[model samples]
Target: MNMPDPVAVFRTEAAELFEQIESGLLDLTHRLNDKDQIDAVFRGLHTLKGSGAMFGFDALAAFTHHCETAFDRVRKGEKPATSELVAAVLAAQDHMRALVDRPTDDHGDIGEVLLARLRCAVEGDAQQPASVQPNPAVVVAEAPKSGSNTWRIRFSLPVNSMVNGTNPLGLLDELRDLGECKVLVNTSAVPSLDVLVPTDLHLSWDVTLTTDQPRSAIDDVFIFVLDDMQLDVETVTEVPVAEPVAAVSAPVPSTVAAPIPPVTMAVQAPVAAAATTERETAVSNADNRQAKAAENVRVPAERLDELMDRVGELVIAQSRLRQLASASMDIQLRSVSEEIERLSGELRDTMMVLRMVPVGSLFGRFRRLVHDLARETGKVIELVTEGETTEVDKTVIERLADPLVHLVRNSIDHGLETPEERRAAGKDEAGKVLLSARQAGGEVIITIKDDGRGINRDRVRAKAESSGLIQPGAVLSDQDLLQLIFAPGFSTAAQVTNLSGRGVGMDVVKKTVEALRGAIDVTSQTGEGSEVSLRIPLTLAIIDGLLVRVGTGRYVIPLSAVEECLELSLEEDLRSRGRSFISLRDSLVPFLRLRDLFRTGTKPDMHQKVVVISTGTERVGMVVDQIIGDHQTVIKSMSKLHHDVATFSGATILGDGSVALILDVAHLVAAGQQQEAQVRAAG
Candidate 1:
């Protein structure tokens, strides 16, 4: 097994820390008096600085320290939290991220500019009137006493803390910075060499400090690691102090066995009483933390992809085994095959669940984007999100990010009205953009809706004609007219802007969504809003499909889309031959004869089956010769040469080593709907 690089781990953790800090700062915009958010932002910056220094990111540490100090002022009531301060820090946070990503690159000029802005914000906040300032008495940290007192502070960090980018020496140096201090190393917990892990720390520390600083100052030293470490701080007073111990540069192995010097009864009495109760509580808390940590293990994403590929291969191999067993007369071979088949299916299901992640993470990233865009465009845009907890395949979410960005930018730039324009239009000054996700069968529908000026059908048609994308005054449905916006080099905007109107993004959005085996649906109502929805499969690796033979060619119909199957006798098939419509119970559903559609050039069997499939509310039936049992399908993408073949989405290998195409349900349903419309027009 290969261990992960410590630097890589630090980078991942630093990314998360950046998110936490950015989120807190953005939330602070809504409530500048939120003390909890201030503290949270301060802690994130403090940890990022310490961890950056630990991982040799000196530039990041140096830059972040200034932001930390600025927040510290707000935290201590020296300067109130203001919008200017939050915006300045948010800008500085971006610089800090650059430092982390490229520590050796020259960022001196940028750093200086950001620091000046931060200083200006802080100085400006300090000039606020007393009536608007925070309550100094209630919010301030306790001031240090005039007289000095000795403190006995002992602490032991979690064994894996050092492995997690924590520097023990940094903590010790901070303690020394407080005042005169003598540290004693405790290594009695070290195990023998044969059984020891090199990365684990087994030592603790005991320190005696003489300082006038309040206890809060001491607590600040361990604030980042306090949740997982054991710390005991108590005052020892009125006793004659021991001889001033010389500062030691390093610890020797001999010190491992050396015992701590005994203290007098005067100091020991109070320490004994406090140690009993506090130690018990610390132990219980530590145990709980350890248990919670053990519950979840963070594995790199590439590893999960690798595991999924292996599972896919296992599924293919099991399919081959099942075919072999079916033909064999040996009872034992068939029994073994059946058992392995069941276990492989169970493993596949579990692997799929592991790859599923909530859409909330993807949605959370848009908050900062919306904030920045609002500031840029001078638009009062309120972004509302729903169904963030809906789960989708990680691959789907990753690929959907860019397409969603394009849709949202277009909505804000073109669809939404400016604040003043909204007011003039008898609408609220703040325009609304809503993003929502929900699961429908095996697909997750993601919708981006904006309340503003809807898509102008006349403008879209005029643009289409002017761009030569359509003939003059061509007849088209409302949906077809709206979809023309996705044509190459199509733009209805009169002028170009930074966010959109370059005629680049919407077409790319269409192509990318289609590449993911997804479909896009657009709807607009004049003067109300426009909604664009993307329906994407829950997973791409494997699927349960109903296999059937159209003449001699076999195809896989996604089982999730199969509503029901009906048998068609020769007489019924002959009667519906011209119309291709099936009356089931009362309503008529359009049916397509696959043998004719594919032009297989093979005669159909006497007993045919109509496999009913649907995409949303529209249903279509495909007539086939035989209905094979359900198969576990591992989808393989079509080659570029055949990618434009709209009838088939992809291909999969069968049990007998032959290839079968996976039907594109959305395309066929649309085709069926068009057929139904044409027949009605003819009538």
Candidate 2:
């Protein structure tokens, strides 16, 4: 039942608003004719300003007002939305976030600097566009005069309204300014001393006014606190033909007993009354719907996490129940265990879906990155994204962000060439970076591609050798040499620049991908472009694992990675010990022996199983004693002490309470490739 801190909520909402504004502005920068993006940006700024003022962030409201005005002009087509304008506003949006975050901090000259930039962007070098003077004719139509209609107004400020910084007296004063006015404060609902909250306003007002101003003027009195307060206004009558004494000097009546006069009655009879009634009804319905929506449901994130933890424990308990049921003679216990197993499986599936978030949220972020990088590098770059609706575990997406950022920065800085360089190379001046993600066979493939100068294999090799990262004259394939760019302190750039070239990004990308138990693939053509792809599992929490017995111990392999399983003949198994190669169809594939790798002294079973696993284009066979049926595995991480154990990615517990190590497919594939290379060298 803990309440959220209002200030923290305000800050969080403000930050989201800023991000939305920046994103919209960035989109508008790309397609200057996109009226929707321009309007969206304007609305975001407008909302931020209003919300800031509502939350007592006067400085933020005042500062954001200027940017909102500029965008409002763009939205209205008074000025075109330009790249320079978007850039200036994007910079201003950052400052707005700082102000929202720490209003008391000394911003000093930063505001002046940004404001100057904003003015230059909006107005160019011209004098301040004449300050948008209001038309005198419209003012004459709006101003109130004598011989106007009288309105009876009744309103009560929200009990906590004053505490929230809404000034009711200011509203009363505004009403007095409308025309001839009389105000009375009602204290009928005021509580006694023991029960009263002194800070909570208990006073309501009844006012009678004669004004030429429209009913909108009366509504404007309570506009700031209208959402939480009660207000009612009705036109009483037109101004009386005969003037009354200045002060009646008589006892005030409880209600006005005046009748409507015919002189100004025709203009106010049906139209104004009907419009006001309709608006109130609509507002009431909207408020009710909003309240109902808020009341129906809400599950806190911590609660969901707690439920997931309980589900994990329930899964463990179910595993124990199944083991105990199998060992017992009672048929009823076995049936109950079977039912529990089914329920637990369904619960796990539901929990996983709850944890899944669409990758589009993550993808939207790179649009801003691409925009900034294009500006910083002074290169015309268009970022194209696809398969954004693909969903992955939230945990995986969270960890993937840093690596993705580094990869993208590397692509912009090193993979893409300058505009002049691109034009000279017979390519379009605007370089293209395509970022795509899609789910394939239980893995998410994220690719960062650039249509710029391809990776120079010779340069990578030269750099690797000069840095002592590789032996001189080392014979390697194109893929192997290109991968040297991921080596620590390796760079081929001729000069270091602010964007990149300290030789840090790619290596970090490599390390992060490896830590996620993911694999990175690189492909390039001499003059076409370069593409770097990361293949990561759909979820890190659990997997459908195929358990197999190797000698006496059990091991689990990701069911996603297993293409198929086959029985290996005793003769073929013995012949492939030193050089493990298997013939399937007409192709030869490499295989590994788990018994030998684990140094299990026991002899292999009569019928050995070869589990065919593949990582990208590399296929490998793992020999085991027996194949166990597929089981749902809740993956548990190894202790920090075993973090360096590359052979197994994780560990999971079996229904029989035994721990089975989950094989690392990438490491095993690499080991198989190394074994194949050694055998070829010997031959």
Candidate 3:
């Protein structure tokens, strides 16, 4: 029997709590006076601090305690929630993640630096706020045993309480801290090893306490875990002076340890009532809300990836079975193979859905970035997002994050102008950066558009010519001219800054998008703005592709890119051999002879076909010997030797136990366009 590590479970939960904290903090920056948001932020911090302390994350607890206090002031309306304060906490949350990820690593003075900044942000030219006083209502003091009242308390925690970092032992000890207490453990609920969940809590305790403290003090002992637990407290009777030991039916057994001296804190009167009342109300609602939330099972990300791999393999195996069945004369085998194919497809769909997460998660992280960037550049820039509900593969989202960050940073530091510049340009005081996503066919188009100072075409041309990248007087279209920004080490900025400059970002964005077998497009106008769109496939693992036989080898064209297929007449093929252009719907579309392109040296079949494929606006015809029907292509990575093969994006295993290369539609389209440009230039 393998038991899950308690510490690992706590860390998983801590990560979620941290995300909630960050989200609330980010939301608070927009509505500084929203009390609900402030309370939400405070609750997240308070929970994180308590959970950290419970799990022995002392540094995390200590660092988070200060943040919690900072928010507590805002919650109590002492100091306001300034953008400075929110930014400080946002930066601190990143460090908290590091601490959660690497608890053993020494964080050094990073926490202290953040704390100092937090203090400054909170103070902000005003006198420092008074320190919060501890609650006096929770004070524990011992009076004479004769004057003490005995109470019988019985409690049982939820089975998952221990797994959630709640320790029953700690609760029992706190109860013991109150005067003379005898605890009786009831283990009847615990089962044998075969049926028991090791991490679950099963034992309940019946504690009899004789203390002079008020009822509120007893309530404070179970303050944190009052939710998700069944607790019953009743005063049996006031004990007389003659029979203190006989207050309860059971004597103080040998298991009862000597009570330690109690520690008392002095809390001011004004703080006690509100704090006590708030705790009670919070406890009342916690059980219902948190119990509902606890239903979700948190699975590790690697496990999902592993599951997806298995599903992909199953899909491939099913394809092989279908091929074998198609060749056989037995009807029953074919029928069974068809059913397996359908089931396998459904399973694959389910796996894909599991991997598809909303783009909102990707979009959410940018709020903090925009906030910090606005402050860093001393610009009033607003971030607007749309189509956040669109979903994409998780792997794509993760890989796209860094490139998107680079693009947004470039937009803020270079594309968007300073406040003074905007005023001079007769534009609104605040510039707008729009981040939007939408699904087109099988791809998701994520665009970063900014309404600020547009690209300086002359500066770009000058930079390219000065760097010897292009001809001095080359004529280029608007789109082509804008694309020069993605050339290696290309930049039009006059000087370097901490955020950008010295020529970076855009070229890397181009490379990253292409590495994912995706295409990027740039559109810009003087004084209006610019939009850089990244069109990436929804999933990189598997796709429905049109398998075509070119020469003696077979290749796949993404079904999403294939429009239609037409037979190439022998006469037309021979007459237009040098031209390599075919008439389609009264338009001349460029065609590529895969036989010549691959240099296979094999004769074309008698009935050759031209498959019309496209990437965005460009269309190209791929000549193949025969067209194989749609195939479920489980994409396999190209070998290191073939990594530089621009024509083939990846390889897939055919149903006939043979391998087929996946054609790179974007690259093929580019090649066709380049050929057309050359042909036109010669003509």
TM-score result, candidate 1: 0.84
Selected candidate, larger lDDT, 1 vs 2: 1
Steric clashes per prediction: 0, 0, 0
Candidate 2 lDDT tens digits, 1-683: 79777677788778778778878887777699998888678768866876777677878877886787677566656567778888988888888988998988998777667767776676655553367533321211222233466677889877888777576766776677567788888989899989999799999999887676667556645543566778777766554435453333232354756664665568676757875775575477558857886985544567777777788778878988988998999999999999999999999999988888888888888888888888887999989889999998888898889888988888888778898998888999888999899998878999999998888888888888899988999888677787888888788889988767788888888888888889999998866889999999998876888989998999989989999899997887887778799887898778899999999999888899899999888899999999977878878889999989999999988877888999999899989888888888898
The per-residue C-alpha lDDT of model 1 at residue 358 equals: 97
Q: Pick the candidate with the highest TM-score.
A: 1
Superposed model 1: Cα runs more than 4 Å off? 125-165, 172-214, 226-289
The TM-score obtained by model 3 is: 0.82
Model 2: residue 570 alpha-carbon error in angstroms: 2.4
- Per-candidate alpha-carbon RMSD to the true structure: 6.8, 6.5, 7.9
lDDT by residue (1-683, candidate 1, tens digit) is 89888888888989999999999998999999999999889889988988888888877876787788678778878788988888888888889888878877877578777777777677773464677543322222223334555677889999998777678887887677567787999989999999999999999999887765556657777766777788888765422334332322122333244443455455557756755555555456557857887998879999999999999889989999999999999999999999999999999999999999999888888888888888899998889999999999999999999989999999998889998989999999898999999999989999999998999999998889988989997877788888898988889888888897789899999998888888889999998989999989999889999999988889999998999999998899899876889987899999999989999898879999999998777799989999997999999989999978988899999978899999999889989988987887787
For residues 148-172, write the lDDT of model 3, one tens digit per residue: 6667788999999876668787677
- Backbone clashes (count) for model 2: 0
- In order of appearance, the predictions have TM-scores of 0.84, 0.82, 0.82
The candidate that achieves the highest lDDT relative to the unseen native structure? 1
Error of 3 at 119 (Å): 3.0
- Each model's lDDT comes to 0.84, 0.80, 0.82
